[model samples]
Target: MRFKSIVLVSHVTDLSGPSEAVENYLKTRSDRLGVIYHPFHYCADRRSRMQDYRGGTLLREARQGGWNLPALATYVKDALFTLFYFLRLGGRYDVYLGADPLNTVVGVVLKWLGLTNFVIFYTIDWMPERFSNKLLNAVYHWLDRFCVRHCDAAWNISPRIQDVRRSQGLPDAKNVLVPVGVDLEKIDLPDKSASEPRDLVLLGALAPSKGVDLVIDAFPRLKERFPQLRLHVIGKTPHDAVEDGVVYQPYEPRLAALGEGVILHGAKPHDEVLAMLPAYDVALALYKPSPNNLSQWADPSRVKDYLACGLPTIITPVPEIHKDIAALNAGIVVDYAVEPLADAIGRMLADPGQWRSMREAALAYMRSYSWSSILDRVFEESFRAKA
Candidate 1:
């Protein structure tokens, strides 16, 4: 009783795992999948977008209300638009997978209205304090718990999220840990010798929480120890000091001030990031430690990308994926500090053999986390349970 058709009511934020999963399904079985995506813009220059896809083809793509829509207004609009869209389709989907609590609530309502057979609440990120506004934060949790209790199942990106859900007293709800996966098929790394100077790469938003600042701070000491080392950052920084409710100082100027050896290639396409990751020897995911940091509950896509590209990663303990990397001997897990980060990179630089071994382990570990395999397993088990 495999589910033949699926739909996702998701917010298109970045090229994260959920996006990759959608791509995987669309590529193979487009006729069996549909998506309603809303672009989460960080700047007013870009307008709000809504895209609809079915059978690997774009059904409709629209931009309206510019970027001035309030958060609550946006959610209401999304829900109403999705309800009408699903109604127009006559609700033939076997499964409805939503990317967040708001999106999942839409799916739950669809099920109540007899539009979809099963609803999957995909929990990508969860923080103790999700919203800065007290009222919004409370509402967010209420919606989150409501979705968890009402949806058929909850798909969490990390085990820690499942633990958090339990602590929130939703332990009885069906929970599945669907960790971030890598696209191994598109990876074509240059077959370079291990003796080549091992350069470092960090692939994510250039925000302080991503440990971009820590990497930059550690760069000088690391350079002093290993003169040939380079740090390649491949992502965009916020235009202002604040955007998307997260206040972060833009690192573009600081990165530019680093002169040479520190390359700041702002926001490359996802395919390009995959192509570029293999050129580096070590990956940095030094996420800052904070109780409110959502990365702590997420299986970061960047870490999976690094592993897939066969680059040994150096990450902090904030993400649960770090424990897996540390246990598998695929990467070093250091504290989120300048000195520890520098020391770890220095250690990796001094031992090329160990570095090579870790790289091999990384590649080996990523085989089990390929998109094709992960998606296949997820749908199979999910559909079986529904049957």
Candidate 2:
């Protein structure tokens, strides 16, 4: 019944939704666990430099650095760091788990080095086909497939991803769909009187594919109806003002030009973000649908968090979220187009009774998706399975 240790490797230590899920599982469960994070070095540096605006500056810096390091240098750097880290700590763990493709590559190498008893690749996104460069994308695919082939088991966050792996010829028994879970006990419906203005809230990384710009574009039309409406954007910003030697633009000014309704809150602490959730009338998951491999296959963590808070969700009709909304009848799923989103928000605001009904259903659905419940099964079944 006891594991010697469970090691989790991921890209960053920041309070990302996926990292929070892993932390929740480790802290609440009885298992012995340790985490090793590979934070983006330049982003971390910019955060230390910029006193007031860390997130935005860091993101800009990351973009400027480009997605990949110069080939020979990256391989050498990753190899050395991976070797040193595993040599120091890997032997103590009975099971090693990696949270993304990058970490999975490292985990597979560590296993080859005989550093751990077993290795599990836990993927939250499919990255190979999502990268911009065809050549690099091919390389990423090869590494991803190599990792999957060598790993003992794979943990996927959505069935869409499991299907992708299977389609790529991976064995069915090697992968399990473990959608991200939320802390239902920590979230509850606050009194409506406590709600702020009928503002829309969007939370997550402000990257290109997140579709924040689309929401900004749609706001003017929305304002024609609800002039008092507000939009609160909460998450980390870019790392620098210059990306790839070009001046990086801030989203604030552009979004503000649409109207005075936009507010940029930057990144808040986990509890603070959750506390602020109930203050808003509706939660938005406005990411654009892309055939880009990652976007098409991944399940967004914010969707679960928004639903767990019992807030009515306005999200795009992405396959995974669409399926959840259809099954639970918990939230509204609209097309990625701004018109549909604007109209949906307007209708929900106009009909208080239906909005309340959706809110209750969302809360009910969240109860069954508690992190405690999900991790108990994950521990007993996946992590504990013999190699």
User: Which candidate number would show the highest TM-score if scored against the true structure?
Assistant: 1
Q: Which candidate is the best by lDDT?
A: 1
Instruction: Report the Cα lDDT for candidate 2.
Output: 0.67
Candidate 2 residue-wise lDDT at 382: 66
**Alpha-carbon TM-score of each model against the true structure:** 0.90, 0.83
- Return the number of clashes found in candidate 2: 15
Estimate, for each residue in 315-344, the C-alpha lDDT of model 1 and write its tens digit.
Answer: 999888888899999999998888888888
In candidate 2, stretches whose alpha carbon ends up further than 4 angstroms from where it belongs are 13-15, 28-32, 40-76, 193-197, 240-248, 383-387
State how far residue 19 of model 2 sits from its true place (Å). Answer: 3.1
Supply the TM-score for candidate 2: 0.83
lDDT measured at residue 259 in model 1 versus the true structure, 0 to 100: 67
